[model samples]
Target: MKQLKFNIDSKIKQLFQYEETKNIFDTYLPGMRSRLESQKGVSSFSLRKVISYSGGAISESAIEKIDQALQNVIVYVDDTEITEYTKQQPLTTASAEMKAEGMYTSIRPGKVWRDTEGKRIQTHGGALYYEDGIYYWYGENKDRTDGNCTVWTWGIRVYRSKDLYNWEDLGLMIEPILDNPNSGLYPEKHVDRPHILKCEKTGKYVCWIKQSGEEACFLILEAECFTGPYQIVKENYRPFDWEVGDFDLIKTEDKKAYLFMDVNHNGIYGFELSDDYQKAEKEISRQYENLHPPFCREAVALFERNKKKYMLTSGMTGYIPNKSDAAYSDSWTEPFQSIGNPHPEDESHSSFNSQISQVFQVPGKKDLYIAIADRWVPDYPIDKRRADLIMRSVASHYEPEKYPMTEEEKREIMDRPMLEDVNTSKADYVWLPLRFEDEKVYIDWSDEWRIEDYE
Candidate 1:
């Protein structure tokens, strides 16, 4: 507990690199930690420089207090003391051990969901695929430092679960082509909303992820088993062209597979897949046509219950919550009836402060469907910017008038560096049960609930 090593001259990012000091900064430094994450070149700037840019918001005395606490801080332990959660690392068949360690027993909405690896489960905008009595949960892996691209994800990460309460990380099923930028799986390209389906006819696992960046399209890959070394069947594949955004895939009881995709800002277009489930046969259904930006919808999650089809969607707001709508139809190809906001009780009608990812029926639980959602940018709430149609949230800009920077100097910060935060591991998940009464759907929020509580 001697005096701190690094002084005020040290780069701010240097302290954040260590978990011990990072916690200290978060506790003592107020808004500095979040500012460093998004604001360009702020992290690399010296501690003193950052405080100056804060325009008297972050005082000098606060820095001295943080430095003193860092001296007496524990070496290894972080502020988030989940020592028991890490007791058994990388567990596969250790459900009993996990429970004994006081880990997962219920689904806690809008909270950090840790995997068996004792790390935050990085499955944002993901889907659940059931096969051989095991459920495979997969989605985008955003575990990287700010890099070259604006909206970047490493690739799709897959995990396995038996009880649906606990997940064991199986690592990346579809790894990106690091050496080749033109490859569909490249790190710069965003491959999100991964919806996987098991083709009973071929007995192969098919994964469909929408890759949007330079060339927006769906990349279809196939593997013999659930944990795949997936072979790309088609890359940059668009069933019919407008442009692709978020998507979902499902195999029906009639032995048919359909892809529910958002065609840019137009509408949610449904495409029926071929027999092998490799390519799109034809466009089947189009729901929720948009007249303008605010009306445009993305994040389309399609599911069927009680012989009827349900489509869940959200507005154009990027990484922020907005009003969610539901549509229903008798047939997959037919037009769906507007059900209005399913979460009417929520004052903002922002889908309980989340965006829908998928809706799947729980095994053996009749009429029970779980709406998997992502509470992206949980720090922010629904506002006028909700319909700005931004694809990503930029870091909070430094205060201008308070800071003593000239207008020319202020403009320079915008060009310092475009920070693309790839570490979306902090993003929380909101999975809630769907309440059905008569053909209409409803989602009621619960802080904590379990599968056993259903039915």
Candidate 2:
């Protein structure tokens, strides 16, 4: 490649043409302009592209610094600029009464979700339960204070919805037991991934939560009502003598409930829940021991389709998003065959820069499932964390051909009324439609969609 000679000052001037781009450079490199202006030589540099350059002949140290600066510049465009621009277009809002009357509502992933009272939805890592014609969502009540902590100090939150779009907060269904130090719900312990199962024999509501602390285990609680002041029925419920991580409760068609958990950070293990869901009866790890790579899975979401059981699990990478894997089998106790990633080719592998929380069947709709995921934002200040910016990196890489949305489709999304809350943190839900072709499953990305679209 032919080299071009230009002073550092000239290059800086060229970058200043775009205001958004200039702002990013300034934010990432405070003294970049002055530092470049002070350099007095006609630098030997070759432009590979408008934004990329090569200075192979330059001093190695100087070249390294320039490379680092360029990388930082790339982060600015990749993360910050795109997210800010997309969110600038405001979403239209509808009246509460209108929404409650069965009006079609839009479901947008990574947008602020609010309840009937207009409070931001606090549920995270939750499960959906359909009972008596209402869908109840139960999840951890994440604290939204300055620290943006994930500890379940307020306990599990419950929200009810006739239609999944608009939810009515039922407050904290299981409050942290502050008075009893021996209680599993004690404030010091981090409680999360709340799964509720209604017993077929006794008609009692059973709740299971992963309690993390000195002795991490699954805590089982029960209540007579769906809206509960559930009491702790069992604590430290350890299956196969392993600490529980992210987990799920799946009730089979045969009325057998099973608890699937990340045991010892290894592959997932299945245990049969007793008739009342109060105790773990048998270890069924032998079935899926070969399905996943050892210690490679967590945050499991299990469901059945076309008479075959399927599971979606995230790699053990803390809060960062990774490619999710899937497995299936004819029987829950039989070995499942790995089907690789269930997402289409896109930025973030069509998982939408999130980890799977749950995969559930839409009420009254056959062969339709929704994959609920958490787009986890760093637990830090907005400016320092750059949660929106990080998401933008993933969003900007989305290939339109892979997930096409026409201008009319875009307008439809913007026109749909949604509740907004300024107090909410950057963490948001990334709910996508789960589609099955033959025995293989895939998740399709939609900007905004309604349940009727599937029907």
Candidate 3:
């Protein structure tokens, strides 16, 4: 973590290295920000000489004062050396002392997590399913060069782990249906919130994804093996009559599986899964139904603690992180009572600046639960205030008049080609330990953590 020394003779352009040095120039050369258009030529000159070119705008005394201040400034930088904020680099997985090979010692949230092959892991918005002694991680694969757009579905990316930290890339278990344009897996379709359930009765694995495209519904797929050419069990199937966004699937203690989903932008509901785990059995209960667009929810994540069912839902802000709501019920099929935002002081502002994806209990730990969230579009400019985001797709659905839009206007919003693409390859994942103090779930911001830390 060595920082570069602030060299006085270095070009003025290099002053963008850190805030301390940059502030020195900003304070001394008041008009320096106005000359940003000519930064390239200005960068060619040393800081000591830039004063001469400033045409009386900057004085020699100001430069010397800047020099005095920069002498104590060390430029914190990244390997990329790009003019951006400092990024956390993943810890080396090569430590032989690790109990599991390729095991990462800490869960570095909001950091670049490289896989065994020294490539970024693409798993996101997916749950950890534990079977036998191994845990399988499944999520959308954003590693595709298909323009780095999330709307295109590559497949359900899969990885396996003996320890939660060390993961082996298993590639795409469910390949995209590239041949059919009407297929939910088409390049234009946005597949999100993938969840896998293992049915012991049938001895098969069920993979379902919330796909929004030609058909806005859950695309159900099943496979005989975990790593598979998962064939479609159902296509364009809407468990309810609405445009669904994100969902979560959980198999309960009674050998029954329940589906918790965002019923369009209206409310959050729970449905029972059929015996084969291929389709939704029936609508069991709906909560947050009374909430209008202002308080509407999406990205439903369900889990059980001490036989009490808990649910987490994020506000309906597309790609932008929002405050997450926590609720609990006596049964998975029952309506949950709102527990409000469960994040602690630092994270209470905006769910640790990450949206809830899923909350899962660590293997072999009865009470230890982990709240997995995605810092989606991490660098996208937005805040916790939902009132400020009128251009968001969900906002149009909730209130068409205040944010009026024609049919074509609505379709053209998220179109990558029609608009400037916000490539999501740089998106980050936020994994925090969820502490249940009595009935409340709290997530404190942790820059880096390990599962063993809980044990």
Question: What's the C-alpha lDDT at position 199 in model 2?
Answer: 92
Q: 446, model 3: CA deviation in Å?
A: 0.8
Q: Model 2, 290-313: lDDT tens per residue?
A: 323222677889999878999898
Show model 1 residue runs off by greater than 4 Å. 1-101, 145-151, 383-423
Q: Indicate the residue-level lDDT of 366 in model 1.
A: 64
Give the alpha carbon lDDT tens digit for every residue of 1-455 in model 1: 22335656666666776787777777877666875776654665667766765668766688778667765654444423312221322423235423332458899898777787666677778888777799888888765422322336667888889988889989888877765657787765677788888888899988888877548888889999777889988888877665788877777888899877778768888888888998878887777786344457888888888789888888765555777889999988777777987887776557777888999788888667999998865655554333222222221232223324445545443333322432354578999999988988899888999898766
Please, what is the whole-model Cα lDDT of each candidate in the order they appear? Answer: 0.72, 0.64, 0.70
Could you give me the TM-score of model 3 versus the true structure?
0.70
TM-score of 1: 0.70
> What stretches of model 2 exceed 4 Å from their correct place?
1-104, 145-152, 287-295, 378-426
| Model 1 CA lDDT for position 231 | 92
Off by over 4 Å in 3: 1-103, 145-151, 381-420
Each candidate structure's count of clashing pairs: 0, 0, 0
Top lDDT prediction, candidate number: 1
TM-score result, candidate 2 = 0.66
Identify the superior model by TM-score, candidate 2 or candidate 3: 3
